[model samples]
Target: MSEIQNKSVALVTQIEGALADVSPSDRAQSFLERSLDLYFALGGPPEAAAKLVTQARSRAQLRVESAVANVVIELAAASHLSDIDMIQAAYNRLDVELKAERSKK
Candidate 1:
């Protein structure tokens, strides 16, 4: 990869690692903070850091959303409840998982 591409990947990987240990409620702020810090640390221009962080954040959000949606679908199918109930159950399970994740931090 080119130098910029390598730095971008490193920034994303660092953010992902930071996010993994943080509560869901804190992810947005954490992502922003870590992204900027990494970008500067990598000798990126201050003017372009915001744009880079935005792109990285979008990619990260999409991955996280996709993963959550897949889990919800799997949970709903395994739950064997009515449509409405299944949705609610899936969300509830997700909430529980979030709580567990938070407690770990």
Candidate 2:
């Protein structure tokens, strides 16, 4: 990797480690913001920093979405409901969890 890419990866790893104890809902945005801040503070240029931030944000979002999807799948499976009911219950649970997470902010 190039210097900026290396730095960006390192910063993202550091941010993830620092936020490891944090709740999932708080992690995505915090990871992106911290990566950007730390990159800039490390004397990265504006253009490079913006690129890094975009990449970081994309990664964080993907992780969060993946986790949510996994939970929905697990919940649906564990409920032993019919196909349609499983989908509905999974979505309802997701909605409630999302609202609860939002309220925490």
lDDT, candidate 1, 28-90, per-residue tens: 686558546645654669888668757866874566678657655754654553344654544
* Candidate 2 local Cα displacement, residue 40, angstroms: 0.9
Cα deviation of 31, candidate 2, in Å: 2.1
lDDT string, candidate 2, 1-105, tens digits: 655445444454543445356676666586557546645654669877667657856764556568667655754554553334654554565556556655755
Pairs that collide in candidate 1 are none
Backbone atom clashes (below 3 Å) for every candidate = 0, 0
- The parts of candidate 1 lying over 4 Å away from their true place are 1-23, 53-61, 65-105
Model 1, residue 26: C-alpha shift (Å): 2.5
Residue 84 of model 2 has an lDDT of 49
Q: Estimate the TM-score for candidate 1.
A: 0.31
The alpha-carbon lDDT assigned to residue 16 of candidate 1 equals: 54
Counting only residues 3 or more apart in sequence or on different chains, how many pairs clash (N, Cα, C under 3 Å) in candidate 1?
Answer: 0
